[model samples]
Target chain A: MLSEFDLIAQYFTRPPRANGQVALGVGDDCALLTPTAGMQLAISSDMLVSGRHFFADVDPYTLGHKSLAVNLSDLAAMGARPLGFTLALALPEARAEWLAPFAKGLLALADLHHCELIGGDTTKGPLNICITIFGETAPGQALRRDAAKIGDDIWVSGTLGDARLALAGYRLNACKNDPDEPLGGQINLDASNHALAAARMHQPTPRVALGLALRGIAHAAIDISDGLIGDLGHILQRSGVGAKLSVDDLPLGAVLAQQPQTIQRHFALAGGDDYELCFTAAAAQREAVLTAAQNASTKVTRIGSIVADPGIAFVAADGTALDLQLSSFDHFRTT
Target chain B: MLSEFDLIAQYFTRPPRANGQVALGVGDDCALLTPTAGMQLAISSDMLVSGRHFFADVDPYTLGHKSLAVNLSDLAAMGARPLGFTLALALPEARAEWLAPFAKGLLALADLHHCELIGGDTTKGPLNICITIFGETAPGQALRRDAAKIGDDIWVSGTLGDARLALAGYRLNACKNDPDEPLGGQINLDASNHALAAARMHQPTPRVALGLALRGIAHAAIDISDGLIGDLGHILQRSGVGAKLSVDDLPLGAVLAQQPQTIQRHFALAGGDDYELCFTAAAAQREAVLTAAQNASTKVTRIGSIVADPGIAFVAADGTALDLQLSSFDHFRTT
Candidate 1:
């Protein structure tokens, strides 16, 4: 096995050749950068550990993409431009093949989104990955959750619930083995749906451009890590407002549409892992938002309205009000 | 018995309030800060994990402080002023008492040093902590490792090897229990003479003021996590220069001076965990560095000079080259 130093060198330190504002990169005491004048720096950090955040047998490449992508979603919520990020990873041992593909997946997104790989640390331990992203936005202009006001239109991008269905092997197409296991059903099912959902769940788009595109335009924003209802409740509580949504208008995917009613509603309301932008905008600017989103090649679907009442209430298709309570994701609630 | 939410609200959320730059802190989707215009952003990140960088039973308080302090030292090395930081902590289970004192220590240092805990994530996993610190400096004027040139004077702050000597438990004090074993010595001693070493080992101060004081004045700088010779070599490689050190000029703490000659040399050359600043400056600015050190209530000792050559060589009191090679902590190399 390659030692830690060799693994770090082979995977991390080649040269700086990415986008966003990367003034100084890796191989130094600390990363350095200059956020443009009139811009405020937006920063967020997250750590993913072995057997906790991912299965021990998971692919390193997917892990790398997920780690960085999650932090980028934080920037998206703040309506800040994606600038660069630092990664600190821990591992039990060094495996060259794993390191090579992992670094490729990591840098590939970095290049795709014009984000610079600034500074990071690699150490020996159980596989733990911590990434911090640095982004910028015009001063006093970044979208804030606390600024959400009553009577605003609540909207979300992309579809919900597919990532949840993927957990059932719907995205993976075929079950790998263990025929008797319930989650292992449909052993011969097509793999494309399962594969697509797996990709979305593991490495969903961060909505960076859509977020920056909403700057000054959207009053409040957040990325949905928890299920739609649960995550939206956060913005409502912090902003001292309430929201009412229609289940009929939810932007769910094809897999979910094909599912029975009960499962579809369950996924739509309680399933998580869709990293789409959920934001609120003024009623007057609704047309402008639709136009801007269209121009950016992203979808914007209005599902409800922020209200004066102080709780999240879901209005079912038949007009019955469902009693709902917010719950945290696994480990987030128990950690 | 407390769960993750209780752990965060009780420990991490309580902290020193930030000043002008930070508009909000903790308990948000993202922390918001507005840096003054005309200032460049300086950033650095680090990660520490239980059973890897630290033992699981190590004092959580000191671990918290040291995690932030090391990155702060990086800011100091660049002559950047402290702004705020994001913390990502992962734990297998939430322990309230452990987190409380840990947050206390971390906030105490942050308050004294004028930094703030902005935002981060708390997740379930083995104990892992990652902190990313942001700082501000004049545009295009941050200190860098590659700026040193031949004939520049090499200097270091505080003493050179107290941290390393303490690790060996030569004559220090009683030590704490190993974090992982509760019985096994994390660095192998009863915290004995090594107590001071271990304490210094655990919480080395970042030289923030010294860095800002040297801004636009010093040629190069770096924080010494990897020990003197090894870290200084980083400067040599980047600057395309060499250095000659006078062993006799190395500053040994009064305790370390009492040790045998061989032990003293070992501490001076190869010991690690001394978070002091090692930097290079023009020979003409030597006096200014001395004056600045006095104002900062620290000593800046000049032990040698950068040379036209491209590697490090030790010069003895007799003015002759030492035959033995000089190297300090290389993380991957087994001692």
Candidate 2:
């Protein structure tokens, strides 16, 4: 068996980047990072465990990508530019086949965002991946959940529910393949649609560029990790406001568009792991919002408007209030 | 079953600290932290998994303390002042009995250090705790592992090896009480002494004050988590220097003082989980080093001298060299 130090050196250690914010990288008691003057550090942590967060036989490369991508999504929600991150991994064994591609997928995203992997810890245990990411933004420029104002237009970037759609497919396929597997409600998806949705689930694109572009424009923002209704509720609760959402206006994922209207509404409204940004902006900034989306090459859809009342009212296309029973993904309750 | 949000609000959430460094805490996409002007941020992450880092049936309170304590020790090694920390926890279930005391112990330490609990993620899985701690220090003032110089006097703060002794006691006691348990080498330890050693293992002091006091005085330093010989070897390898260690001069813990000579030497030399400061300073600065230790109320012991050679030489009190076979704890190779 490879020693821990050797394993880290072989898989995780990288040459220090020139002109990087990190003064010292790995092989130290603590990594030293120089925050830019007049900037605030934005920090977030996310942990993914096998069989709970992902399937036991998930691809190591995609698992690594999703791990850091989810954390980077948090930074994107805050309109913070990626700086550095630390990974704490627990693995049952140090396998060369698994580690090689895992590091490759993780570092590829880190490199694209100019984010450095400064330091981390690896130990022997059941597989778990936890990343704490750091980013920097000017003071008062970060889009916070509490900053939403009544009458602001609520917009969402890209599509939602593809990841959740993929999850349903996986559950259904597992039940069909093995009768002993627990049944999750029935769902039908073609192989091509399943692959597209799975890609969205495994390789989420963090809207860092869009987040940076929306700085000073977005009144409030949050990444859609726990479904739209539940995540948007966070903004509503924190800002002491409500929302008038057009249920028919939600941008459906290409794969979900093929499903029935009921499935489309449910998946798009309450599906988790979307990793898309739901942001609020001034009603007059509609043109600017479109321009920003164009500049980042990401699609944007106006789905609703913030209201002074305290609860969300779902409206159908013909202006009738829709009564739906839906809940966001809760790790403890749902799992 | 409690939801993830309710669980966080019930046990982990605390009121914002007065005049704290954190601009935003929990309930946000990311926590915002303001770094002191002209200070560099120091970051470190540590992950503890059940059955690997701690006993499966370990007390939740002590486990909580140890989880954060080890991460804080890394900040102490860098001579950094505590700022804030992000926790990522995984639990099999939400049991109030376990979470209550666990959060109490964790937050108690954070309050003592004035380190706010900013933001984190809670999920359902096999129990694991990962904390990424941040601290601040003036540039060029951090005690780095690569600063050790030839001819510098090697010093250590606090006692060593008690944690390893306690571990041996636990192993021996388990074997004696349960025939099905794996047999570890037999060791006799009275209950009183065992308790003393166990406390050292559970609740370790981070030596932050001593690290601050020795900011410019010590040329290089590292916290000894993996035993003296191995950790000191890191400084030597980093600085391209070696050391001449006096085997008899090592400071033994109170409980280890009663052990046989061979046991004392082995435990002090290669036993892991010690969390003490092993540092090196100029030969002429011995008095200054002593004063710094005195001010911090921590004991300082000089046990060796840096050498121009490329490997450590063990010297006995009688001025003769002795060869010993020893290795530091490796997470993958060890249990």
TM-score of chain B of 1: 0.88
In model 1, state the lDDT of residue B263. Answer: 59
CAPRI-style quality class for the chain A–B interface of candidate 1: medium
Off by over 4 Å in 1: A1-3, A18-20, A170-192, A323-335, B1-6, B15-18, B170-192, B325-327, B330-335
iRMSD (Å), candidate 1? 2.4
- Candidate 2 CAPRI classification by DockQ: medium
Question: For residues A1-335, could you state the per-residue lDDT of candidate 2 as single tens digits?
Answer: 23653575459897986646899998899999999998999999998889877887889899878889999999999999999999999888888888988999999899888899999999888888999999999999999999999999999999987888888787677666543212233356989999999999889999999999999889999999888988999999999999999999999999988887877888899888888999999999999999999988999999999999888899999999999777666211132
TM-score for chain B of each model, two decimals: 0.88, 0.94
TM-scores for all candidates: the values are: 0.91, 0.96
Q: Where is model 2 chain B poorest over a 10-residue stretch in terms of lDDT?
A: B178-187
